[model samples]
Target: MSSPSSTLGGSKHAIKLTQGLVALFAFSCGAIVANLYYAQPITELISPSLHMSAGSAGLIVSLTQIGYALGLFFIVPLGDLLENRKLMITTALVSIASLAAASLAHSPGWFLAISLLIGFSSVAVQILIPLAAHLAPDHARGRIVGTIMSGLLLGILLSRPLSSLVADHFGWRFVFAAAAVLMALVTTVLALTIPRRQPEHQATYFELIGSLLHLVRTMPVLRHRALYQGLVFASFSLFWTAVPIELTRHYGLSQSAIALFALVGAIGATSAPVAGRLADAGHSVRATLVALSAATLAYTPALVHPAFGVYGLVVTGIVLDFAAQMNMVLGQREIYALHAASRGRLNALYMTSIFVGGALGSALASPLYERGGWTLVAGAALVFPLIACVHYWFVGRPHAHGRT
Candidate 1:
């Protein structure tokens, strides 16, 4: 095989777009994805202030992830059957409203409910991605996608420090309120600028859902990838979920310091675009393997020693997340390429599994950390990618057909 970045390796079906359009879409991606993660840094402050328990405090985050999962499975597939530009615009408005609700919640449970809405509404990212893939020509798909994903990853990474600093100085409520404003701007821009896509699938809701089920049943590539990517997401959330407490407990770091550490890891996600380029060049499967492997390696230090391993885990987290995002971009690219008409259904299968993993990860992080310390938590994460790797290598890759 050629080097991973071998100038696109002449893949005809890969998607490409105009540089100007790419820049605009990438900016939109960062702005929109930021809405989902802006709340991460404020979890600590919000739980205590709202009179919720430590574990229960996490419910806000978990429920949002769950809502996103629901959107992936239930709402995103409709992109095939609906007018996508209008759908994304409407969803962004709903997202803005949900952010406002979350900002104003008076009780912990109320906050979680609003979080669910925000998450569900945030599936605009899902629709945007498929649309991006569809809009671009074949050769530059990876490059175009990489460009947009960079924005998304940047938002995820920076949300921690940005939100933390805002909450610390102004108040946590200001964080959500501010994001709502950004969402409104994003909603307006997308509505005005996005070109329209006519609906293709006219299946009923159940019929659409059946398409997703059929995808999981028949598409070996999708199933294999979802299995690996699902656990990749779970491990991703597991480390992130525990990192705040570890920083405070073992290092005696202040909230500000913890926020800084989260920011550091977020910066690591910049690897997504480079990975996407590799995929466009015909090395996507290998790139996916390399990414999952790196993530597994990142979990190693935490298993050996909690205190010293904490620092290593932080460094590893950066690498782990970079790899996970790489895997994600490549997997989605592969699925979308499989059949243009089925992009939405393929995405639904891929992301729903990932969100399920994320939800499970958030719920498990506290108990896993509490019971066995960082070792079990890290070790457990260490196992998932390897399992996924094995299944993909043996069962999934050999039988797969060519994608677009």
Candidate 2:
């Protein structure tokens, strides 16, 4: 049997989180995660400035996500073995350097390299999430995770418009330069305000990473949650990455106009907090299904009419983002409940899979768009969530009502 403190750790009555700390984690995560996306909307601006070809511009986005996936697998697992506060601060410092270097990069090779470093260090946000779960009682875990995720989703949604607007006025380089400055502020706040947390598990770095594979094999919950969120995230990546290109190419939108379009999608960030509440109330399975259906349906407008124009695409963005954010928070809530000692590793595997899917989506966006345009991209994007829905039906339904 677990110890009394361990037992209490799972109960809402034992420990409660402060609103200020929660807000700090949320804001820091938003600020840090925004680094990965600053390149997406401004790829058009960056490509020509560096004398790179349009065909290869998507690489900037994909490589950053790829680096994030790698960090999730390799670096995030350290959360289970190290002190959380120090780890986050260290990673943020590295991210600050990368962002600064990216701002000054004069060649495609330099920019791409810096992008990867920026993504790798941005896994600090993932470490912060599990740290929040560790501090929160089990009953409030979902709500806390949702609150932090709301910041993350806002970062993802707002990054586009923010980058676009900044790039329009001050050039794309200024976006990363400004991001580096904000990252420095976030790092300082984290170092000062966040409490230290040391995990109970004792293991070497290799042992921690090796244990991840074993967990994947043993825990069906990790597999299913990761798979479901992975597919939904792929759809999310496909839409956001492709739509920016479409906005410029098809609709002839200026950078500021595209920024406004991205701002409209920010409305979807509201789902994160709501999804958290639903999970806290033991409605994870129901919420997961609704999220999947929303994702699949989000693509229908674009598929139905290739000529549905920019408004239809914006509607699709809002709905897709809502579905993706909701499903992701629900997934994290489920996995975080698995093993208190293993929350960090569990999150590592879960997010690694999701970002792997995201990498695939971003990597494929340009080629698919160039080959067949928006209709093909919409049809291809629909397949991912559809696969997730089928998996949920066949394997995830009966087990959904209870934790696996």
Candidate maximizing lDDT? 2
lDDT (C-alpha) at residue 244 in model 2: 87
What is the per-residue lDDT of model 1 for residues 211-326, given as tens digits with 9 covering 90 to 100? 77777887777787788889888888777777766666667777677677777787666777787788778887677778778877887666665556557867767887787888
Worst 10 residues of 1 by lDDT: 1-10
Q: What's each prediction's TM-score?
A: 0.91, 0.96
As a TM-score, model 1 comes out at 0.91
- Model 2, TM vs. native: 0.96
Q: Report the lDDT tens digits of candidate 2 across residue range 1-404.
A: 01222222344244457998899889988988999999999998999999988766889999999999999999998988887888989999999999999999999888888888989999999999987887776677788899999999999899999999999999999999999999999999888877677666778998888898889988888899899999998989988999989989888999999999999998999999999999999888889999999999998888788777888998999999999999999988888877777888999999999999999999889999999999989999999999999999889876554554
Q: Which predicted model would earn the best TM-score?
A: 2
lDDT of 1: 0.76
Model 2 steric clash pairs: none
